[model samples]
Target: MDTSTSKVYHVDGYDSRQYLEHYFSDKPDLTFKDDTLIFPIENLTKIFKKGHIKGDLMIDLSTGSMIHYLLPSCEFFKRILVLKVKDRCILELKRWLDTRTGAFNWGHAAKLHVDIAGNSDQLQDTEEKLKSAVEHVVKCNLAKENMTDPIVLPPADCIISAWLLDNVCKNQDDYIRYLRKMSKLLKPGGHLILIGCLEISYYTVGKDKLHAFSYDEDFARKALGEVGFVIDDCKVKKRKAQSDLADYKAIIFIAAHKVK
Candidate 1:
């Protein structure tokens, strides 16, 4: 498949429920849990526990209708606002947030969160805390100067974007442009905890294949520096599960602070 011809995520849109079922369901599949979930939660726990990333507000621009990613952050941040690129994703997230019928079960993820934090008994507490912290879910357009236009959000103390750039950016320049847009959401000296795939060009969600930017660690480091973020930590984990859903060689997690 030609990278140029791959389906663009923001334009072609996504099957939010299908995506959640495939990658994040509470099935017997342990591949996604071990390979994907553990890394981000571990790093997030480490960062938040150390009191490195602080402040009252934390904005999440993560891909899909992901709630597991917010579990650990609930311990530290006062308020969490989610920004979505598509309406479908927002709806899917709201289903879970509101505890509506047919909401994707995240019990497994909540357990994993508590287990990682060394308090396996806090599963329900973690979920409740996350729900309380997440205040709003707003629609956004990265192409616009004011991504959250008309809604006007205050500059955040921290922003966590997971796997969004890999799917949204068509090239290196686009990556920088989008990163700059995300950077603007943060105040001076604020932190950005970014999670993305390295050298991955496409990922399958349901029957559709979505485009992803194939960039290495050097490119990522350079892109962060170019956007005026001082990289504080960069961790990479090689692909552990042998699956065909995505062709990513490894996952990259970076914690960086905006240059004051």
Candidate 2:
């Protein structure tokens, strides 16, 4: 029930997916009718192409909706490491990867590893659930791992996180620490691409009353710079929906590279 550490919460014994479905059912603005989410996929594709992510090892730090958008394009990677801070996100990603007609390209030789942390559930059960959803042809290794602890991450050529920094970090120092940790996971010349909300309230996992840090683009750029990352290209856009009656404007999309 603790919002800080626990990644998932069950309501009426239903799983996280069921909880989300029920929570979003009443929200007119949040719609999941299509295969993809609300974000502009065309813009993401352009950013990916500009970042030159092909044939490189990629690590998705907080793979939320970005997983749905980027998985198909990531076929060229030698290996892809998806670190989902929330259990439900991991399950959703696993479901997508397991499907035969999903965005996943089975022809790729890349290995898929899904990491989940901040959950009270058994690790084995989580792994089994992921395994059951996966297709037989896709070469994937599923496991439950904690992101806060020291992890032997694969050498990634690029690290991409979408809407992660603002949610996980408690303050500026925590944000810096996260950036440093992610930098350590990347290769010397690897890049870090982040698409996040600049200043938005937290509304996910059935907690509609939660609040998040008011993120600023300048602070984020400075944080990346302090961690020896050069700002290659950055773009900020406001995401608005007619039915969404939120006070804050959504600032999305940012990309940076590690300084050699």
Candidate 3:
């Protein structure tokens, strides 16, 4: 009953399958029927389909074992580099990529993606495209100076961080640090897309609760500006208490350009 208390869990041994099942689903309540739960992703998917992001390579920081959001980007970028904080997360992603027997099912999210694009027929083709675009699913630590060191990656045309920064950082300062780190991963003038929680203190993964930074739109815009990025687009959808997944007030989606 005490939701206020939360303990951070390392990505190494976390139950990724369980986490995936709880969040992404075909169930309308948690999926297509609810805009708050699905809008952030829907909005991103639409943008990618429209070719908002450019370049041959796209890099995603802290993919968190979910490929639903990346489906759209797969079409535009020939190569994608997805990084996860824990090796376990990277492994979780690979299981799906490998099409293992027990891999997490993303039918619901995929369906939603096509639904938003108004092209239900391309479901299977779109799924295959996503699988093909992802060239690397590797380990990463945003706190480090070199986010993906030991494996120097080429500068990206665009970068995306979805709910990873909010979950990893303990405070506003940490958020700024990671934002700067993420910005550096992109080429100058490259765009940065972020999907994050707004004013949320904690989120649950299975039975365990985890810490999250509670930040608003003002804080987000300022943080991006202070770190030398220009905002191109930002979308904020109010959060609905449909589930106890997290106590967030809203979800903020931002597309910004890194300063040269």
Best by the lDDT measure: 1
lDDT of each: 0.87, 0.52, 0.77
- Runs of candidate 3 with Cα error greater than 4 angstroms are 1-5, 9-13, 31-37
Off by over 4 Å in 1: 1-5
TM-score (C-alpha, index-matched) for candidate 2: 0.65
Per-residue lDDT tens digits for candidate 2, residues 77-165, read 55566666555556555655655244333111111111112223343343334333222211112222334345456677877776566
Positional deviation of residue 243's Cα in model 3 after best superposition, in angstroms: 3.4
Ten-residue region with minimum lDDT total, candidate 1: 1-10
Higher-scoring candidate on lDDT, 2 or 3: 3
Task: Please report, as a residue range, the 10-residue window in candidate 2 with the lowest summed lDDT.
Answer: 107-116
List of clashing residue pairs for candidate 2:
none
Best by TM-score: 1
Clashing pairs in 3: none
Quote the lDDT for 128 in model 1.
Answer: 77
